[model samples]
Target chain A: MRKKILIVDDVDINRDLLRAILEEDYTVVEADNGKKALEIIYSMKEELAAVLLDLIMPEMDGFQVLEELNRRREIIGRVPVLIISGEASVEVENKCLELGISDFIGKPFNNMVVKKRVRNVVNFFDSKNLLEEKVAEQTAILREANITLKAQAEQLKKRNQEIIDLLGTVVEYRNLESGEHIQRVKGYTKILAECFMREYPEYSLTQDKINIIVSASALHDIGKITIPDSILQKPGKLTKDEYEYMKSHTTKGCELLDAIKSEWDEEYKKVSYEIIRHHHERYDGRGYPDGLSGEAIPIPAQLVSVADVYDALVNERCYKDAYSPDEAFKMITEGQCGVFSPKLMECFRKVRGDFEGLAAR
Target chain B: MNLKECYASIGADYESVFLRMGSDSVICKFLFRYFDRNEYNGLEKAICEKRWKDAFIYAHNMKGFALNMSLTRLAGASSVLCEALRNGQPEDGVSGMLADVKSAYVITEKAVGNLERE
Candidate 1:
């Protein structure tokens, strides 16, 4: 197809002269003034290859046309404009250049120079548009790659959680605890953490933090593996010294967890470490290992401590028969096993029925 | 005389016009007719009405046409007239420049008529 060139001049003779010169190689579209030229420029902006503009005209002048084109830079950016003026002073040419004209053609339109300049400017823009398309295509590809990388990372995270859950089950198997123990602990931690978040906004427990606490709750007794099988599986109660030695499981679990590292998320690892080391710590600062006081123990460990003790009371073990959910709830709230935070006791009271439901399962 | 002889006699560069216009006599005839019908009268009317901007437009148009046809002498006269009106020259000075343009237009018109006969 012939590339269209718009010839803008008020004088019919000037338009004809340009058309006669350019009409052979290009499709010449004529506008008698700047106003009409602007109309054509907008309507045929996509098809137009270049514009040959006269500096002086009725209604709107070349400068005005250039100003409007500058305002709509996208149009002028694609369609090159060459000023065709009888005025052709250096001042006028420089002014058009400042207005962002592609080229300048003096009147009496040199047959060769006009055609060549128009062709050159048009070719330059065509290549520029092609480069822009290529860049856009590459950007889209990069965006797709980024999305795939994000999905793969998400899949890897799910797999890592599975490995950690299996490892928790192994620890339970070795200690002669059922797989349901970990499940019950996780469920209880979630319920308590959620209630804590709602009842006390100061904790700032976002859903992500709750999820980490839940996952980390599974490994709270991971240190129990370090205790001797004689103590872990003993049918009778431990002697005072033996009980004191068994209490070191909290700190021993922290050391075992700290020794090994993997590619798991750092926040999850940190929550796991806190739960392992301080889940036995009492709210009144009387607990073993750290003897951390109220609010001094990390909230994750505090919540896990409640879940661990409640599960142990409501579920059967070698040393004790299982207590009813009501009896277990009363014992924990009445400070039968250890002193817990008042706020946690409130949350536990609210979800006591839910805990009973889990016990039934 | 033939169009070429007539063009040469009046100092119009006929060969350049022939080459530039692709030897299309119809386009040549149209341009000549346009020049004859309007060139002098348009400037005369603008000057008579004291429309200096209109006068500059007409004079500039004439200069462009004359330059395209390689009528350098007429183009030079029209360009001078255009510049005078453009710079807001005194009425007497503009009138003198307009006279020079009119004299050149008359000679160019006669030559165009002679070529049209061929």
Candidate 2:
């Protein structure tokens, strides 16, 4: 399609001369003065390819028109302006160039020069717009690819968690503990961690922290895999030396996890390491392995400690019958198995009914 | 005399005008006639009223038209009158420039009439 050009001149003969020169290659629009030209520019901004503007006019002159165009940033770059003036001087040309005109054509129009400059500028803007469109298209494609990559990473992460849980159950089966033991511990940790997040803003137990604690709970007893079968599966209470061998499970579990020769998310690895190494640490600095006191224990491990003891007490094992949820809860609260943080005990008290419901199920 | 002789007598470049307008005598005649009907009367009224700005506008417009038509004498005289009015020259100096413009316009008109008769 032929592009549109606006001819702005106060004199009919001048406008006619420019129209005669340009109308062959373009659709010409005429305005008698700057004010009328501005009106046309406003209404036909998108259609116009260039403006052939005369400097001297009544109402608003060429300089005023250029100023208006400069003020409207959206219109200025989009439409190229060619100044046609009788008073063409170096000063006028410089001023128009500073105002961002595309080209200048003096009065007594040259047929060839006007046509060529107008065509050249219009084609230049056309190519510029095409480049911008291509860039926008490429950006959208990159954004789509980034979203797909994130989803695939999430899928790979879920697959990795499944493999880790399968390895954990292998260790549970060797000790004659039900696979449900890990599942119940994960569930109870989530309950306690979520309650703490809601009731105590200072604990900063965000949802991400709760997820890590739950995932890490399944690996808390992973060290038992390295303990001798005789010690792990004995039908009676452990001897002192056997208990010492049993206590090595915490440190050994950390070693086993550290020994895994594969890449993983650093956050998951850190959370799992904390839970496996410190879940047995006592709140009062008396429990085995590290005797970590109060907040010295990582919050993830502390949460898992309460969950592991509660699940162990309420679930059946090869060595003992399952205690009722009420008995398990009393033991944990009364500090029978080990002393827990008072804040964690408070969270446990709020969700003890939910725990009984899960055990019953 | 022919239009060329009359144009030469008035110090106008008839050959260049003919060439620039693509030898279109009808267009040349039309523009000269348009100026006679529209611009000349407005310029006379403006000069009579001593409205220098209005007189300058008329003179500037006539200067551009005369230049395009290759009427060098008329274009040059109008340009002088335009500058004199624009620069706020004394009344006697502006009137003298206006007289030169008027004489040039009369010669240009007679030259156009000669072309029309041909």
All models: lDDT? 0.83, 0.82
Q: Would candidate 1 be rated incorrect, acceptable, medium or high by CAPRI criteria?
A: acceptable
- lDDT digits (tens) for residues A1-361 of candidate 1: 9889999988787787778778988899999988999999999998998899888776898999999999998987788889987777899999999999989887555576777788889899889877988999999999999999999988876866775686697687885467788889999999889989999998899998898789878988888887888888788999998898789888888788777666667777788889988998999999978899899999999999999998999888988899988899889999989899998889989888887888788
Q: Which predicted model would earn the best TM-score?
A: 1
| Fraction of true interface contacts that also occur in model 2 | 0.09
RMSD of 1: 8.0
Model 2: docking quality category = incorrect
Candidate 2's TM-score: 0.63
Instruction: Give chain B TM-scores in order.
Output: 0.83, 0.81
Task: Please give the range of 10 consecutive residues that has the lowest summed lDDT in model 2 chain A.
Answer: A106-115
Taking the tens digit of each residue's C-alpha lDDT, what string does model 2 give over A229-296?
A: 89888888999999999999999988988887777777788888899889999899987688889899
Candidate 1, residues B1-118, lDDT tens digits: the string is 5667767777877777666555646446655767667578988888989888888878888887787777767889999888878854434578888888888888877766666443
Query: Which stretches of model 1 miss by more than 4 angstroms?
Result: A144-218, A223-361, B1-27, B87-92, B116-118
- The DockQ of predicted model 2 stands at 0.23
Clashing pairs in 1: none
Per-candidate interface DockQ score: 0.30, 0.23
